[model samples]
Target chain A: MKSFGVNLLIAVIWLLLSAEPSVIAFAMGFLLGFVLLAVFQRVLGSRDYMRRVFALGRFLLVFAWEFLAANANVVWVVLFRSKESLHPNFITYDVTGLKPFEVLLLSYCISLTPGSTTVQVTDDFRTLVLHTLDADNPSAVRARLDRVLKRSILSFTR
Target chain B: MTMTEMLTGMLVLSGSLLILASAIGVLRLPDVLCRSHAVAKALTLGIFLMLLGLWVYQGEKQTALKILLAIFFQVVTIPVGSHLIGLLALQKDIPRWRHRPIDDYREPGNRS
Candidate 1:
């Protein structure tokens, strides 16, 4: 598969860059190479993402912004908000037709954001249960997930 | 220490603060699910910052690559682990310590 080639390229690059040559180094390179490849799966997919490298860059930029902003949001809530003020609640969002990996990756992305943590996927795997630090405005949370998070992930899956 | 070293130290310090925030959430937050919020977000970012600071201090491309690998694995595992823990906590059906009106998951049309 093309993913394996990406891994091989990473390994070769690692071998070329290293000063010492050893089997351990090679093995480490191979392993790390696989990790790198998996991390870029969204960008290097066989069908949908192969030609959307620019889109991938855009996604990363947005993710970086979200990560920084979300961290700040969480930092404020955690450091300043009283326990009584906390509006923690559970949400069940229907994924409907997303691939298994898509659901998993989306959950990971959601978890990394400040206010949200994925609780569990449903028995049929079509629904994902989530918990949030704030759920007073359910529409806002749903908007972010659908308009931003879920849409961005669609490029990887579809 | 050099400026780079100073910066690295600052980064690591900030990372520790985030970790502390997650710890406070664990101890002070009313329930397992709520606390998992801290573990999933703050803790992951904290570990990432520490690793990134170390990567910068190393200042070698190869070292940076290795650090990235470590970070990648950490990022991959943390959410999966957190999700499972949250599921277990849900299965145990432990009521939150506060027990307020926050059970939105039971709302109709929320689940499709």
Candidate 2:
């Protein structure tokens, strides 16, 4: 019963996020999605469902902070620096998280920042090749990213 | 021309210029991933500029709100698009240029 309720909420969230549905479409789509969810629910089981949502919430909070900082730094660099000050380089940094989804999210967080972009993510998912406008402070930057990722991962998974 | 019309024309011109610059950068960049970055970042800015220009040109609250929505959508979409394309390239085994020894995402057996 608890599993079904969560499944129903997930389906409804999916529907709301995806499209604007007419009353008929909404009811039909929710019914179809709910039925499919029930099958997957039995197969997958409700292992760490709450953990996933909590992890996402943590990621969002940390991401917001990083985003604000990156944007401000970018604007400052653009406004003050001449073309000569720019040093565009691609740097790969080690990411500590284990899960595929977690690694992917970290890569994304790095890429979404203004100065840094993820050019590649390795298959083993341990490393991330990031392009940065200024690669001068690579160590500091990598350490900073490592700390933030650790906080987000630990905050929810623990 | 009225001041409003002149302002509108300038905004449109600037936004169009940004869009053209991004398009050219995407085509001219040496690598696929780099080109994606150029397109993702510049095109987003271009769209924002154009939408804001349109908002200013219309000088209506509703159009301005719509323009804000457009910008919001672009902001959310561009990074996701870039990540998807990058992941796809990795899946396809695209070679990345390494200018120096750095380890953002590089490890033995983890090369994508």
The numbered model that scores best in lDDT is 1
For candidate 2, what is the DockQ?
Answer: 0.21
Tell me the deviation in Å of residue A32 in model 1: 21
Extract clashing residue pairs from model 2. Answer: A92-B103, A92-B104, A92-B105, A93-B103, A93-B104, A93-B105, A127-B105, A128-B104, A128-B105
The digit string of per-residue lDDT tens for model 1 on A91-143 reads 77778888888887788788777578888877666877788777778768878
Q: What digit string (tens of lDDT, one per residue) describes model 1 on residues B65-110?
A: 8898999999778877888899898778788755566455653345
For candidate 1 chain A, the 10 contiguous residues with the lowest summed lDDT are A46-55
* C-alpha DockQ for predicted model 1: 0.50
The per-model lDDT (C-alpha) reads 0.77, 0.65
* Quality of model 1 by C-alpha lDDT: 0.77
Query: Which residue pairs of candidate 1 clash?
Result: none
Model 2 residue B64 lDDT?
A: 69
Per-residue lDDT of model 2, residues A38-102, tens digit only: 45755656445545555768788877777656545544543455545565566778764568776
**Model 2 stretches astray by more than 4 angstroms:** A1-4, A7-55, B1-77, B80-112
Kindly report which residue stretches of model 1 are placed more than 4 angstroms away from their true locations once superposed: A1-50, B61-65, B97-112
